[model samples]
Target: MRNSRPIILFPLLCFLSSTISILCEPNTLVCNEKEKHALLRFKKALSDPGNRLSSWSVNQDCCRWEAVRCNNVTGRVVELHLGNPYDGFDLEFYRKFKLGGEISPALLELEFLSYLNLSWNDFGGIPIPSFLGSMGSLRYLDLSYAGFGGLVPHQLGNLSTLRHLDLGDNSGLLYVENLGWISHLAFLKYLGMNGVDLHREVHWLESVSMLPSLSELHLSECELDSNMTSSLGTISEVHFTALSKLKVLWISGTSLSFHVNSSIPTSGSGRGFLSGIVDTAPNWFWKFASYIVWIDLSNNQISGDLSQVVLKNTFIDLSSNCFSGRLPRLSPNVRILNIAKFILGTDFPFHVQKMNGRSKLEVLDVGLCGA
Candidate 1:
């Protein structure tokens, strides 16, 4: 009788411990019904031929759906990453997988949504929905290479909390008449408008310089000209002085002939400058050149004596310019240097000899420079 009693008590204790363990576990939250319905409506508007949203079914929890991320605590959809997955330049892959059709206004229902990326998808040249500007909760928005056409909606300026905005590489289809709206994005860190036609925006520089927090600015192949450079000289001397946080600048292939003045302020911990045109290197540029890691002023009408300039950059490409006189002394950290198609004097061999001991120098192209 005593042995039977001990066995009964042991089983009871096991059951009690199991029940207590189950009770101590936290309850998992399900996706909000309203937000789930909004997501369904948003998906219904798009044509997903690739069936990328197959997981987004009615029976399943919307929180576990592909490209949709919900907050763990509140179960509110906070991010929608519907960008194309392909990263290469293959057009067939892009065409086969790209998401098309109109973006539904139902997205406005996601009150807490912040990150939205729809880059590299084919939208069939539709104008960017002006309603996106009203979604004030968005912090990271990327619509680059998405085949968006026509004028960019100025209402996007309302996204004061936006940190990164990329509308670049839309096949020259996107254009903006007035950039006054951009001045409102004071918190913007990265702004990319490459291949977007900005020939009409006369005050573009003035508006861009207002972003004191901007670290990377990409305006490549945007039809910017000498007129834009003139505006930059004036606005940059005043407004750009405040952009001390700026690090990477890419204004290549824009036919911009930069004329450096003494008044230009030495601001920013600049890392790269890919300005394709410059009449003379600014004094302020050399003052901060030591901090620059990459410099590319190639294929321009720049004619300057770089011999006096000490380039501490890791990569320097001053090729296809009218630079004359002796080659500039290479920094020990220089990895790739290309001064091709420019006369750097007959003492090129001497310069190469001086750089022989530097093991980091890998690519040296002084081709057709009267070497």
Candidate 2:
């Protein structure tokens, strides 16, 4: 009996040892060969002047390459974070490190790639590759400030899984004539097109409101005119009410007229315009003021007696506006308040006098006010 047990145990020990060796093997994991070749092809299409992608080589495992991420088990490339490391303001550093040349269609081969960021790079003002719309697995796509010009490809509407999309700040070069395609992004949560010309997209809001999942919307410097605002007013209240999940709304530096209603749900909201004409702040606008965390109606033609208005937001910027009479009462939680260039009377509002002790006021800018 003892001899038989030793023989059986001997075979089991050998099997365990072989399994351990296989698991412990170094450099056993490598990215899929097809995907690796795809990445190499994609890199070949780009001009990396700073050698930022120097590690991208056929000899090295593509999984180990810079700005490339792969699944731990499947070894499939899932993310490409080729965004410029330097800040946008650092022009010298950007010029030295930026990637240019055409974005190759090879990226379409990465069927598992879910995130792609090519922001802050220079692409020589070329149109965004329309083929990008075919990458169905993409959930996050950022091409902001990437020097892409001309019309934004409507084909991007095909990305039904996209949750975050930013095509902003191309120095006003990117423009979209129609946004009807945006309505196709059913699952989109954040949409940013700041500085992109949307002056021609008259039905923009209608397309935007179609996204029930949207939380953050940024359209600053889009050159939106009053016509869009008028169109917005025409949109049924049911459409605005559908944006219950919206938390951030920024439409600054345009010619948009600000109108508030019970349907608009927002935590951080700002409305800037070149010719926003509001004779008086609507009483209903104050109805949702308590839910707002930030409010900026600066540099507009808003005129009213805001003494009756009470702002509970943490930040309030009503500067460069034509608001007259006494200042609005600030809530105890208000931290930043700016009313520069207001026509409020020479006498300081009672709230401003009491702000020193009653509120959490930190940054107060009342400069150029009549007071």
Candidate 3:
């Protein structure tokens, strides 16, 4: 009786152990059923004319679907890149893949999602979903050129872990009432809000400066305030001590009013005082020389001495402005220089020769400078 019982029990134990090992194997791991249903719900909300999400059907695993990424171990959705990837130089490819639909709030189901990109698509002028603020795990978000309308939702400030944000190039449909919310994103490094109206947001500069980790700021053509220079002087006194780690700064085509006191130098200084121009005064743009790599201050009504500020950038564009007086010498790292449509002095060639020898100076466009 004892020998018969041991034989039966040994076979049962071996069968249970083999079943447990098969269940725990990596090949058996599939996308979480809850998250998979969420993805299906998200697809249902959008009107994808291009059929970009055809592979997101029930026949396939969600992890193997287009624009979806899942954690290998936990099998949780972590990233979604639903942007029009073909919006580069290929016109045919762009027309084929561009999605036109509203972003769904169902994305909240993916609690572990860290990356989301929905740029270069047609969203039919819909407002960005406010619920995105609740996605606490988000690290990168890009909604550029998505055709969204209305004021930027203040709820986005709740994303304390966000590192990069791009809501730029949405035509004139998107804007900000104020930039106060941006101060909360302490880890934000790159902020691109180009072409969004900031005319009403007077505290734009100060609010942006509060971002300690900010490296690149692109606010070009954003209808910035006319009081930019005066605000910069004030900001320099207060936040310049805090210092900017900004590498790329683009404020071109924004109607910036340049009204500086006559105490500042307009002409070249040789340790000699001129009756007309101020001699040897510190300039605001000069302070940016050390930190910035690329700068574009072109196509504005900047009326002042061009030689007033010294910039040491790799790429500098001061074209189509009312800047007079001697040009500043280019730094050794200078590669592209555009100073077109300026009233350059007779000694403009001198600065050009100085750049030719020490710097990697290449594309120097002095067209219409009257040099």
Candidate 4:
């Protein structure tokens, strides 16, 4: 319940006794038999740290195993969770105990599966199979930090019931050839692909922006930049017109110099912009960009005062730029603004009083300014 993995395994004898007691009920017995197949497949895939899963002996029934949940009505295996089982294990120990293997294809056999968390594992370089998308009942799919690669399968679009999808920290996935696949997913509410590289599938960025149901989008390094400049180029007025409901967009990028092995100034509507962050501005932009609440151009050569900013919920940043002018008068609704290390002729407003009036203007990082 804490990490959302199953943690309820009773002793075999107790389970057997419980099963025997329930055997008299025909429906109960039938449900148990139906669930047995899924449970068997689950046993084959489990790799536990602390040898706790050793108790998941083939000799014993898995109905009593921890980290597995069955539907009481249908008696089907509906949950398979594997995450940080121990809160106190040191990093090295945790790594050793971590599970690593292909997500068994047999998972498709368990049609009732509703939730899964195979995140933070040492499962290196094992790509998620394409069949995973066909599991229409899957509501939660988390494959964070698995080091798996390959394009995110287009089949994932088939899961109309999916609500939470986290493919964070997966360096193995370098391309996204099927952007249209995810656009049809109207049910998805929370999407996380932090540190995922979209350069291989930049088209998906444009395609995914069309989803009307998307609310929370978390795409951090999605490339390599610590700043969120690379992601800016992906937004065209044509693509984001329907994203009226969107709230958060967090991309990552490098410093002002590309010193960190990233893009310096994103250019072209769809060409030079890096992955997660977008630093450079294309020559033209439509007025619809005013919809974005936050614009983080922290580490790039973005020149200009915050004058161009008009979004109400935004925290515009011009840090590490060549901007040289008076700090722009921020709207009362603005939140965070960073304009550090600029090659400018003006200075950070000495009054600091302009900031006190706005209730939402929380963080103001003006480091290394010439003011």
* Candidate number with greatest TM-score: 2
What candidate 1 gets wrong by more than 4 Å, as runs, is 1-27, 227-236, 260-278, 294-299, 315-317, 327-330, 338-359, 365-371
Candidate 4: C-alpha RMSD to true structure equals 11.0
RMSD versus native structure for model 3: 7.7
**Candidate 3: which stretches are off by over 4 Å?**
1-29, 88-91, 227-243, 258-282, 306-310, 343-353
List the pairs of residues colliding in candidate 2: none
User: Can you write out model 2's per-residue Cα lDDT over 1-371, one digit (the tens) per residue?
Assistant: 85999899999999999999988888566899999999999999999999999999999999999999999899999999999999579989999999999899999999999999999999988999999999999999999989999999999999999999999998778999999999999999999999998877878878998999988788777866554565556434555566777666666555445554222223223332444354455655554544457656666455667777777778777887666666777778888888887755335442453443477888989787763
Please state the error at residue 310 of candidate 4 in Å. 4.9
Judged by lDDT against the true structure, how good is candidate 2?
Answer: 0.79
Cα deviation of 265, candidate 3, in Å: 23
Looking at candidate 2, the ten consecutive residues that score lowest on lDDT are 261-270
Models 1 onward score TM values of 0.79, 0.83, 0.81, 0.69
Better of 2 and 3 by TM-score: 2
Q: How well is each residue in 1-371 modelled by candidate 3, as lDDT tens digits?
A: 85999899999999999999888876645798888998898888887767899999897889989999989889899999998988746877876777776677788999999999989887878898999999999999999988888889999999999999999999778888888999999999999998887766768877887898888888887875433333444334454434367788887877454334333334433221122321122366466544589888776545455454556788998786655566776667888889887643345332443543466877888887764
Q: What lDDT tens digits, residue by residue, belong to model 4 across residues 324-362?
A: 545555667777777666656455542233543546777
Tens digit of lDDT per residue, candidate 1, span 1-371?
A: 86999889999999999999977887566899999998999989998888989998989899889999889789999999989997438777777788999999999999899999999998889999999999999999999989899999999999999999999999889999999999999999989998888877878878998898988788877877654455555323455566677666666556545465222224422212333343655545554544456656565545556566666778777777655565666678888888777633335332442543445888988787753
TM-score of 4: 0.69
Whole-model Cα lDDT per candidate?
0.77, 0.79, 0.75, 0.60
